[model samples]
Target: MDTLCGFMRDIGRHLSKPVVMTAEGGYANPVLGFDPAADRVVLLAQPRFS
Candidate 1:
């Protein structure tokens, strides 16, 4: 997770636009903190299929 977060932070340095993050596949491991690079984050509950 550290590697992944490091990559996101590295990428964020070059981006001028606002970064929005979707917390996917992360509920299992549960990262309690939001990414510093993200301007906003969208957290989804477990999926419900019809």
Candidate 2:
């Protein structure tokens, strides 16, 4: 879990947007931006499917 978090942090820091920590430990909050744009994040307390 630590390693995964580290990687996530690295990715988040490299982006210009915020990467929130979801209730599921970053599940619904995915890394947005497919092209060469600033990355964005969106985290929810619960998964939509749940």
Candidate 3:
């Protein structure tokens, strides 16, 4: 997780843009708190499929 976060941070630094993290279903909490590079975290409700 730390490694991934580091990589994301590096990418954000290189791109000079705020990275947005979208949560689908699993691992939402960690992505919200752990990702420092993510400027915004969007939590999406589960979609219902017909």
Candidate 4:
């Protein structure tokens, strides 16, 4: 999954750092999201690993 991880890395470069450490911004492929109030963090993907 090197390619996948690489893509993630690239996407990460575009994201803005969260003001609050507990928050995250990654919900789309090549994106990220984290929330302390939610009690979970998820990286939404296209579901197609093509």
Candidate with maximal lDDT: 3
> Which is superior by lDDT, 2 or 3?
3
How much is the lDDT of residue 13 in candidate 3? 66
TM-score of every prediction relative to native: 0.35, 0.36, 0.42, 0.30
Runs in model 1 with CA error above 4 Å?
A: 24-50
Model 3 per-residue lDDT tens digits across residues 1-50: 56655665666666776444445765543332223344433233455599
Question: What lDDT score is found at residue 34 in candidate 4?
Answer: 39
The local lDDT score (0 to 100) that residue 7 gets in candidate 3 is 62
Show the lowest summed lDDT stretch of 10 residues, model 2.
32-41
Residue 38 of model 3, lDDT score: 48
Cα lDDT, all candidates = 0.45, 0.46, 0.48, 0.40
> Each candidate: how many clashes?
0, 0, 0, 4
> lDDT of candidate 1 vs native?
0.45
Model 2, residue 2: distance off in Å is 0.5
Residue-wise C-alpha lDDT for candidate 4, range 12-33, written one tens digit per residue: 4445322122224642334343
Cα lDDT tens digits, model 1, 1-50, are 67655555555555644333445865454432334445333232455599
- Least well predicted 10-residue stretch by lDDT in candidate 1: 35-44
